[model samples]
Target: MKWTPQDIETYLNAKEYVDTAVVPLLAVSVGGEMKQSAAGAEFITLLSGHLERQFTGRLLLLPPFTYLKSNYGENTIRDLREWEANLAKEECKHIFYLTSELDWRTQEGGLIGTVIWLPSIPLEHMNDSQKMAVVDSQVKQLLELFTQKWHENQ
Candidate 1:
């Protein structure tokens, strides 16, 4: 479904509903230390905290699923698809995928993140800041959207 700003407004207004936002970040290292890197941990912690604040009593943060191998196999895709489907069934209103490309040989590894707002917020209207927020703290943005929608509905 196309997500319009009004839809975001509507979802935010609802009294009680399950809403979820996903952020997928990719990292690579020569020694598989990226998972334990300070930067990685800090980024995840920041995003988690932000979401928690936004959702307050209604947020559920899923554990981070990291991929160390780069085969990009069919099974990998299937697993991701299944994850998305499960979130959908849980009545998730937002889903964000944050990705980063790593080139160990070139030492050019960095973050490239994207936020996917599902079934509710329209993709077209999202600004750069909003998209970045998805990587940083998408839950807060979702909560903002929810709050806006709630007020409008009333």
Candidate 2:
């Protein structure tokens, strides 16, 4: 389910069947790399929305977890772990963090959730059809990975 009031209500009613939580990890920056950060955010947000639609009732797609690009390290891990802990208490068996920031890969060991890193694709230049095609392709690839993870855990 997407993070909307109506979806939350639906989730609350059928929370038992939704065992997974998907979070988009976004990096914000106002410095020289501002454009890149924004691009990543846009890509991940669109991709995540598409992903959530694919499995609306099976997982909850939380809002993007934003952190400054300049501030990443132990603090980031700590904050994300806090989120994981809370989700676990809510009965989320699988927590997936999706991002376009490659730096997060290094900190995966400290996280209980799975971290998926995909390079950012500039969507600003693409037309609606093009953007949909690109996002669709990425979701297709991710569908296999998500299913594999679910099966392994089961």
Candidate 3:
């Protein structure tokens, strides 16, 4: 399910079965590196969409949790924790934060939910078929990780 009115309606009807939330962590920059930041967000968004499709009934795809690249620090982690708390209160058993920013990897230990950091794959030059092929391959690997996490918690 996605974070849309229609999807939320379906999700409410099957809330218990959809115990997971997938959030894409996006870092925005308005400097010279802005293009790189946008590319990372694009790649992550595509990957998250593909991932959600693979587990539509089991996961809720939330909007990107965006933060300024220059403001990524203790405050950012604290805000992300608040998101986790709210989701947990709503009975979400699993929360996954997917990102292409390497900074997230260093802060994973301080976070309660899983933080998956993948190096950004430049997709601007890829054709539709090529893009699908790359996203599919990444999602396949992610599927294993998700299932493993589910089993561990069970």
lDDT tens per residue, model 3, 34-152: 99999999999999999999999999999999999999999999999999999999999999999999999998888778999999999999999999999999999999999999999
Q: Could you give the C-alpha RMSD of every candidate to the true structure, in order shown?
A: 12.8, 0.7, 0.6
What is the alpha-carbon lDDT for the whole of candidate 2?
0.94
Candidate 2 matches the true fold with a TM-score of 0.98
For every model shown, what is its TM-score relative to the native structure?
Answer: 0.45, 0.98, 0.98
Judge candidate 1 at residue 80 and give its lDDT.
61
**Poorest stretch of ten by lDDT in candidate 2:** 69-78
- Write down the worst ten-residue block by lDDT for model 3: 104-113
Model 1 global lDDT (CA atoms, 0 to 1)? 0.46
lDDT of 2 by residue, 1-154 (tens): 9999999999999999999999999999997999999999999999999999999899999999999988987898889899999999998999999999989999888788899999999999999999999999999999999999999999
Local distance difference test, candidate 3:
0.95
Candidate order by lDDT, highest to lowest?
A: 3, 2, 1
Clashing pairs in 1: 3-122, 9-149, 12-146, 12-150, 13-149, 13-150, 22-96, 24-98, 96-116
For model 3, which pairs clash?
none
Q: Candidate 1's residue-wise lDDT over 107-135, tens digit each?
A: 21221112322222222356757745654
Best by lDDT: 3
